[model samples]
Target: MSLVVPAAALGLVAGAGTRWLLVRLPRGAPVPVGWCEAGLAACWAAVALAVQAGRLDPRWAALLAALSWLAVAGSATDLLVRRLPNALTVPALGLVLVALVPAGSGAVQRGLAGAVLLGGAYLVVHLVSPHAMGGGDVKLAAPVGAAAAGAGWALLPVVAVGAAVASAAVALVAVVAGRAGWGSRLPHGPVLLGVALAVVAVAVPGPRIPG
Candidate 1:
């Protein structure tokens, strides 16, 4: 397919580039260059390919996807450092806004709403048990909203349901592997991005429902 070329190529290139950045960047934890790049790139490219196939507008899909990658990277930082660095998060979002002029900035407002919702959810959880949620999650919620909002109304619910399902699956994985325990923190950012991407994939192209 016409889209497959860029999808696969971008996946490889982005993966390699991310690996380079991860290795060269001064950081707290030791992570493999190949592993992180390959993994993240694969996810990005896969989302792109699905979008292309679904016959959605390519530019809109690409724009949201780029934001999604930023979200993924930000979330990865939370997983690695156990903190959301404004140094990284703010700049990434600022760049997103700049690129968004052509794309239109309306989604940014929606993203803010998404962020507020997520922050509120985490806040409630924190009130119930501070240890159950983290401030980093609030930082993580903004872009998920942006991505879904960029896609339009249908995506919000899709993103919510998808993220919840992904989170539960991850929890199940952790529990089955004995990685789950009381007070153990789960990385919600990754799951949020996963839901956004899943919606992207499904919204683009899939089996049609019988009328």
Candidate 2:
């Protein structure tokens, strides 16, 4: 509970900064302040609680926070422009790889492998069904995968499966509601980000599995 206050404060700042950047970027659209505040506050508080619960160390918490920030920005951008700019995804991927350096040689190796595997998988999907998956989503997958790998190797498949299932469910609902058709493009960044965070939160407390 003590962590909540500071976490909320930091969340407010992070949310506002994210929204500010979103507005300034090309094809950027404004999101409701309340929604942004609540979403970011929740994400920040989740990290704080994970640290308090000993599920994650300060370094991992910092990395998650950074990735969450990028996810927030990427999600909003993707929603508006149907594109995830390299500006966000590329820097996020670089940051995750660099941040994992001090986590240990094993972690670095796992993170890199996770990035390659997930990124490559997405690339293949994109190549096969360019209309179904966006290039931006392909880029976003690397960092999300790296974060999952940093959490645990087993988490990579878990996150991937979870995201796929969730995205499919959402798409199915959209089709049922007539909001989208079978071939419609959905914004995938948000789903990937959400799954990554959830998987990290759950897996970080477990014994580290070798990648």
Candidate 3:
């Protein structure tokens, strides 16, 4: 309860920033301001609650917040343009790597390995069926993988499976509702980011709360 107001305030700020970024994206359609604000606020608020509940360290919380914001921005771009800019994904990967420095040697090792594994997997998929998976998604996978790995090596598989299931579910709904056809290109960045965030929230150890 004590954390709610601050969390909400942060959400407002994050939402505004996300909206501003979306508005400035090159060759991108103007995203609905209301949608951006509402989505980002809700996403950030959930992140805040997770941080509070998990009793995460300040550094880890900050990393999570930053990743959430980037994910929001990336998702918006992908949805509008069907592209995730290198401008966003490259810097995010670097930031995630740098942020993990304080987490410990083990975390750094796992993060690097996770990045390689996940990014490579995506790259392979892109090579096999470029139309099915975009380069943007391939780039975006690295930071998500790093974050998941920072949480735990085992969580990497969980993130992968969760993203696959969620994407399939959403695709099925879209087809059933006539919102999309079987050949439609779905923006997968959001799904990947969503599952990564969930895995991080669950797998990352937090400070124990005293009863």
Candidate 4:
């Protein structure tokens, strides 16, 4: 509870750093700094709140926070260039794995399993239809899936279904509005990361009031 505000403030600083980092990247550029900061702050605050509410274990906080930041980076990159750079996604796979060290053996195993599950699935899709899914998305999934599963195994299914449904809904809306045809491809990284972060950070059941 007491840590939530500080967490958000830290997020602002980190978000600004993220913006700078993005601008420096070869393919990353032109993200609005304010929006980035606000988004990261909200994500930080949500994770803090979840921790205070006991929905998230303190042991897993670092991993989840890292994943949140990665989500921001991946989303911005995907939205800007419609590509996920190996510079970001590949390194993230190792970083998140390292972040899971303190969580012990069970978490390490679960996280690895999650990575294989999600990343492999994306890879299969990419192999089947390169136009449908990109290699960057597949790489991004490994770390995101690792962190989500390390935090909560249930989040794996939640993120998959949520991202799929949300992407489908957005595509439908775009088609209906004549902005895109049924064949139009939307960037899947943002949708997947956003849902994964939300589910990992705040999807646990809230405290029940007197009924």
Against the true structure, candidate 4 reaches a TM-score of 0.87
| CA lDDT of each prediction against the hidden true structure | 0.59, 0.78, 0.77, 0.80
Best by lDDT: 4
TM-score of candidate 1 to 2 decimals: 0.70
C-alpha lDDT (0 to 100) for residue 44 of candidate 1: 63
Clashes of each: 2, 0, 0, 0
For model 3, residues 1-211, the per-residue Cα lDDT tens digits are 6565677677777777767765675754456666556665776676677666666654566557666766777777778767788777888887887777766767778888989999999999999999888998999999998888876778899998899899999999999999999978899998999888767765554754110
Which pairs of residues collide in model 3? none
Q: Alpha-carbon error at 22 in model 2, in Å?
A: 2.0
lDDT of 3 at 194: 80
**Candidate 2 structure, TM-score to reference:** 0.86
Clash-forming residue pairs, model 1: 54-204, 111-146
Identify the superior model by TM-score, candidate 3 or candidate 4: 4
Q: Rank the candidates by TM-score, best first.
A: 4, 2, 3, 1
- lDDT minimum window of 10 residues, candidate 3: 202-211
What is the C-alpha local distance difference test score of candidate 1?
0.59
Model with the higher lDDT, candidate 1 or 3: 3
Provide TM-scores for the models. Answer: 0.70, 0.86, 0.83, 0.87
Kindly report which residue stretches of model 2 are placed more than 4 angstroms away from their true locations once superposed.
53-55, 206-211
Ordering by lDDT: 4, 2, 3, 1
lDDT against true structure, model 2: 0.78
